[model samples]
Target: MMRSILQVPAEVLSELHATCKLTPYELKLIGELCEILEPFEEATDKCQGDQVVTASYVTACVQGLSHAIAHIRETYKSKFVVTKQSSLGKCLAKFEDMECFQMAATLDPRFKLNS
Candidate 1:
């Protein structure tokens, strides 16, 4: 939705309403936010299915999300995004500490067994 708004011309936005115009900084922030949330959205999509998703798959998804978020934190210039990424990392950290997820991921042939 934010992406769609970003695509609209300033003239169109202004025509829609006086307050509809987004400043350059707001547009940049929205773009950064979209980039930050993309990995989470992909993970959610991967989890949704008629077939059951195993713990190993979920564990892998969490790991992927962590890596993506970490990359964003390191590379992104936005302080707000980096701060939010830190919060997201903290949320995901709990799953990493779970024995079940750890064991399942270790047992899954697709994932490297961590000694």
Candidate 2:
């Protein structure tokens, strides 16, 4: 929805309502949010499919999510830097101690040899 809103022209937004126009900062923030949340969205979609989702698949997804988040943190320097750090920290903390997930990821054929 935010992406859809961002696609609307500034003139159209202003024409719709004086207060409807987003500031440059807000637009940038929204863009950052969309980029940051994309991996999570992809993971969610993959997990929600009709096919079976095993622990190995879920572990791989989580590992992918971690890598993507780390890349985003290292690559982007914006007003949301703190937000990025917070998210990375939370993700690590939540999954760091999950030995089962680690084992599953190591056993998964796709990730078995992955470094």
Candidate 3:
């Protein structure tokens, strides 16, 4: 929907620009934000199973999100553009000392030690 709306012809937007919606920069930023958030989305989907609990995924998910955020930071190039008041940076900070999550992941039987 956002992409389609962003793709509307210039003539249409010219008429409605006052009330229409996002500027080009805003559209691009949202697109980048979605890319940054994709790993978190995937992690959430992975945890939505009935047969098995996803407790072990806590550590894994944090690591995955951290890596994804780092990739976004590097791949996006413009630090000022991508990291201003960065939510991704804040999310990474929350996991910086996730020893509890690591312990939980280590305790899960499916992750190697089953005895």
Q: What RMSD, rounded to one decimal, does every model reach?
A: 3.2, 3.5, 4.9
TM-score of every prediction relative to native? 0.70, 0.65, 0.54
Per-model lDDT: 0.79, 0.72, 0.67
Model 2 misplaced regions, further than 4 Å: 18-20, 78-115
Task: Supply the TM-score for candidate 3.
Answer: 0.54
Ten-residue segment with the worst summed lDDT in candidate 3? 80-89
Query: Which candidate do you rate higher for lDDT, 2 or 3?
Result: 2
Write model 1 residue lDDT over 1-115, tens digit each, in one string. 9989889987887678575567889988888888888998898887667785467667778888878877887878678767767776787768877898888778878777667
Candidate 2's displacement at residue 68, Å, is: 0.7
Tens-place lDDT digits, model 2, residues 1-115: 9889789887877678565567889988888788888887897776566765455566666667778877887767665755755765676456645887668767777654845
In model 3, the clashing pairs are none
Record all residue pairs in model 2 with backbone atoms less than 3 Å apart, i.e. clashing: none
**TM-score, cand. 1 vs. native:** 0.70
